[model samples]
Target: MANRSAQDIRRLNRFEVLRRFHASSGPRTRQDLASETALSFATVSNLTSELIGEGVLVEAGHAQSGGGRPRALLTLNAERGTLIGVDVGETSVRTELFDLALGKMAVDERPVTPEDVTPDQIADLIEAGAGAVLAAAESPRSRVLGAGISLPGLVERERGVSTYSPYWAWRDVPMRDRLAERLELPVHLDNPLKASALAEMWFGAGRDVDNLVVVMLRSGVGAGLALDGTLYRGATNSAGEWGHSCLVFEGRRCRCGNLGCVEAYVGTAGIAETLRALAPDDPLLAQADGAAASLLTGLAARAAESDPIALAVIRRTAAYLGAALGNLVNLLNPETLVLGDQVAAHLGERLLAETRAALAGHTLAQPLRAVTLRLSSLPHDAVSRGAAALAFEGFLNDREVFGPVSRTRGVKARAEGRG
Candidate 1:
């Protein structure tokens, strides 16, 4: 047990070291890594030496110095291996291929019709899409380190089971096993809430902030929480199901069969419901059945033009979203609350301003003052990028299985000082 504990500690330290390199824009020196990761200088030296020997990291010359010898700089070897991140939404299955440094190499997306609801159907789509993305990148499957899959609805990470999917009425589907069997690689499963939060922590607005909240708006609404610089998954790993929390008593019916849930008023479907309620004859309503992405895009476009009915829908949705967000602010008191996903990106600052205004009315003076509300800086493919981050973490945990880079296999070892 003691040996195992020490091994776990070593692995975690290695992961932190590699994560710092991936997050950094340029090469990092040994001292820089020690300071950033809070590891001992000797420990950093040992880990970096091991990684350098494995070809996962390579020395990139030396840093400039005013006096004395310059420090050697280290950076990730992009040829180490590859990772894949897949986002399985209600309307689409998008896959992204990335190098060891998490730089995107290729992307492939396939539409998901309403009929494609079964686990096997979705898994097949994911497998095919990942293959297409790898082919686009001209990367062989043998070089792939692993894959991270982000799905909508509740997920059981340890068991790799999807506990529930509101759109498809799926219960306890073994998603991770299914994908691992088909892809023949290490697989990590998580909900979009967790994936989005990880993305923010690793690369977006939450990179510097310790406490943050990421609210994702799409076909459904959810919040991902990062408290004290760590994701709080709760006891059951279902902590971020904020969208299902009741917002109104006996109000609109939600797709989850719950009345007055926050999602019923703020999700893409809920926004469309509001539009239909206000103006049933609106042309955008015609596309709501299976083309929700188009409908929301149209709604945002109409709202941008200051169309009365569209603006009304926006205003009403903002009020609901703001109030719900206010509750989050008061309870969590996060340093930052980021609005993300396609819906938030489409509405942009117009919706942000109104939500902020509405949020002020509901939150306490002190907490509200400390919290900053903003849109996500990540691209529309934030979820998939985050999924790739998941794969990266998995690789760091069990790197021995993937072995060393093929390109550096037979190279002669250089001096330890340079590495």
Candidate 2:
């Protein structure tokens, strides 16, 4: 939670009004906002007028049937500006463009292998991707309010610095300045998992849920924490490093050279490693030749044919991840646990069933019963989309950058009905 102060109370109140209005099912009148936020109508009215003056919200129109004088409706003004998102994943850079309401307008992607990725190379990819997206969208470059980059490492967002990035081999780089210089736009940077969690809160499976945890399963395991609709990064911004959390006591070696980490047993790469370790003589491991996707596909194929070895591997993987899920449920007791990313793509019903059973067995009965577990219904591009939302949200908060245009003027202009 941000530190509240007498000086910033009004700012915070305006932000709250904007957030509530944005998440609402439709444009909300002052009366509606007051009811939803438990604030007085007078407070909501002043806040909405200020928001309209700032071009953040517009008095869209009156409700069709309010009986008497149709109450004015306020909606987020889509013309405020555009937001850009770049997802720097394990092996690719994806950039996306979005309107104020989180509607995707265009996207572009570039590939970069993890080992060879460098700061300059990654920056080049981001620039190119953003350029491609903007060109495709035919949006004027000046209209882009800002850009956001979601990396796969620890970040110091306050300084716009990436403390460390394992995927791109970067350390203590002034990433925000570099991107801003290249793109000539304001930028916000954060962890991809954080972006993903924000995406879930805004558009994906965790939508409408206040307390939620978004788990990304890829070569490793990680989590995104949302506390009361806010992304909760730990003191060091390493809050979701569940991949590095130890699960086994002196167990198998992890990629991070740790013993008994949960990720070593439950991640897609971890499952592949386990397959190779346990099935040295099996044809499946030989067929995959160490590709994570191929290995998972091979395991799924054999499991489909009722291969005991394959089924056992999957069952064990499920148990480990389920145990990890149990830990999350107990600790956070979130309203939802969302499984997403590439690893989730390979999970079959059998894996889910085993995971569900393990979760039920491991967690406290009450929380387990209350929590809903669901597979991610988001597209493979969720990371990029989430990053875009991060950019949009960052842009919205900095009110100094906005200029005031009175609520009455906005309503009068609307009466003229200009698109």
Candidate 3:
């Protein structure tokens, strides 16, 4: 890794202070922040002062004191700015608007089919959704700090390109630049894996855990890794393409044109295929409604009603999911393995238990004992929320990347519905 410049270190330090402030339940004094972040009192004070001056933080009364004057308390200024998070899935584009506090203000989803997707088409969808949310919230574009968009498949993050999208068959699509031009806002692009991992780290199951693996089980499956408290992008920034890992030799073909990938057996299409194989004449399989999400929901409902075929399908899926998760546990030894996204949300604990049972057979006892597998507690909108978290981080880490909006202050004045 290259050495961090003095400016970079200052940015990180400022971000660390803000991170602690966001995570705190109430307010904090500079001394409390110093103790928590282990920064010197002077450093904490300086950072807090800068943030307060920029309207990123506000004084929140004062802390109790045994003697002398009470210390002033500080808290995040939710009205400081807004953020946009977009989840561009094979089936739809989900966009959400959030305040500086990461509270959701509005959300919108637009249907999209993988076969019909193009860089321009996806960008248009994202722009439309963002505009809808901002309009719903009655917020101006100038208040938007930045937008974080998560795409499926391999993403070249630094270059803002969708290097490869198995679902859409897209290669080297310059998505970030396209969105930036259309929205006229700073844009950050990454895949769902990284976005989901960031969401988990910030507000979901991995909040307290350093080593976490978030397995996104949708039409396009992948893992987002957080190792040692940071997102681990591999040398090529495609580290978490766990879905494409070979699971069976010469088995089912994957959307990525690979044979026997983990996603071929565990993703939404994989689960549907499993149902078809178990009962070729299954009514759900022959339904005119072609949405995989609807099919999975129906299957999950049947499983809940104790249908034998659905139960069996669930078991079979568990076996595949368990094997995939077990491999992850054995290799990464993550503290938590979170099952997230649409399909996982549909199956819930039934899949969790069965997968745990199946995972036992594949994982070594030592690693299995150390890992805890659970369904993600985040809402179905995890990807978009995570996308927003990404934008938030980018803004905090390097304010310049967010452009002029973030540079200006007086959020307190703007919060009163005035520009």
Candidate 4:
């Protein structure tokens, strides 16, 4: 049994090596793979053959040789498997399909109305979006590896449940099981902020940095933290609830029933409300009572032009944002600070400037100076891409991290009358 287990472990490692090789370089010769993975040529050749036989890999072409025999190049067969990534936002659902190589093949979106959107209705929308993308990509359903859903909330990843979502009014929802059943595929779920952080770690600004913080400022605010090269999900999987952090002791009331929370000042609704109050006669503000996108666009345009009222509102918001960020910086001392979401998309540079100024005014210059503050380059799609990345990582790492070991242990215990 010990020998068999060892063989299994070795096979898993070989499979991982092959996957990583293909992931990084698209295709490579057996000799090149051996060199890259630091495995024996015979081991590489054998594993490549096994993966090819399994239809996970294929011989793409021959590699050019210097003087000896040309080597056959192996590439991942993307058509062999698919993965779905769904971003379930407060007002919309975005879905994407990725091939085994993690290349996005297709994407679609649907608007969601708050009054009529239930958890199950939102789930159906996600399912429909995933199906649409898959069909558009011409990928067979049988080849789907899994689906990943990302939302704004506290997700208990272990239980596949959403503990709470303030935006969606969801509590104790079994999001993963429902989606898995509906789509007939394995499902993974996570918070949208954390998903964005994972996306950053995999392909964005946080790639090389170990200690980092990702603050997403959109309709709402949230943070994703990476500490010591691992995501730091706190005791209840709600570590980086930046939006709810109280900036003032006796300030304005927030939707989360808090006083002077960051969201009360910087959230889309809050900002729009402030704008309306300040400039009651402004045409944009007059027309933006319940229109989120229009209000945001108008606000962005005014801020970009440095309108006095808009600038004042933005500056005040920036001050609060900066103060909050300073506290976070002092606590974590991260290597990078990523600003994302809709607000960041428009006002990132100015916000970063003000945040830095506030940090300089408050914290010690040295530690804060080392932290790189920047905005997300992936606009409009950060959460969705991040959701997709969450799915990808779950598929790749679940077995190693969470999969059950030794089926015989349960059987043996039962046989021994211990159960």
Off by over 4 Å in 4: 1-77, 287-290, 397-419
TM-scores of the models, in the order given: 0.91, 0.87, 0.90, 0.81
Residue 290, candidate 2: Cα error in Å is: 7.8
Lowest lDDT 10-mer window, candidate 4? 406-415
**Candidate 3 global lDDT:** 0.82
What would the C-alpha RMSD of candidate 4 be, to one decimal place?
7.2
The collision pairs in model 2 are 53-405
Residue lDDT tens for model 3, 1-419: 13544444455556556766555578899888777666777777777887787788899999999999889999889999999999988778899999998889999999997566888888889989999999999999999989999998888877898898887788998888888999999898888898888778767776667689999998888899987666788898888889999988899999788899999998888888998898988888865145887788888899989999999989999999998888899999998999998878999999999999999999998989989999999898888988897787767645554222211011111121211
Stretches of candidate 1 exceeding 4 Å from the true structure: 1-13, 37-40, 400-419
Look at candidate 1 and tell me the lDDT of residue 406: 11
In model 4, the Cα lDDT at residue 258 comes to 77
**Best to worst by lDDT, what's the order?**
1, 3, 2, 4
Q: 3 or 4, which is superior by lDDT?
A: 3
lDDT computed for candidate 1: 0.85
Which of the two, 3 or 4, has more TM-score?
3
Candidate 4 residue lDDT tens string, 1-419: 33335434444335434444433656788877666545666666766776677666788989877887888888878777788888887778899898876678899999888785778888889889988997898888898877888877789987889888888678899888888889998888888888888777656776566688999887778888977655678887788998898887878788787788888777777777677677778787765554667776776688888788877767777877788888888888999998888777766677778777766765667768779888876657777776765665455444443233211001111121211
Ranking of predictions according to TM-score: 1, 3, 2, 4
Query: Which candidate gets the maximum TM-score versus the true structure?
Result: 1
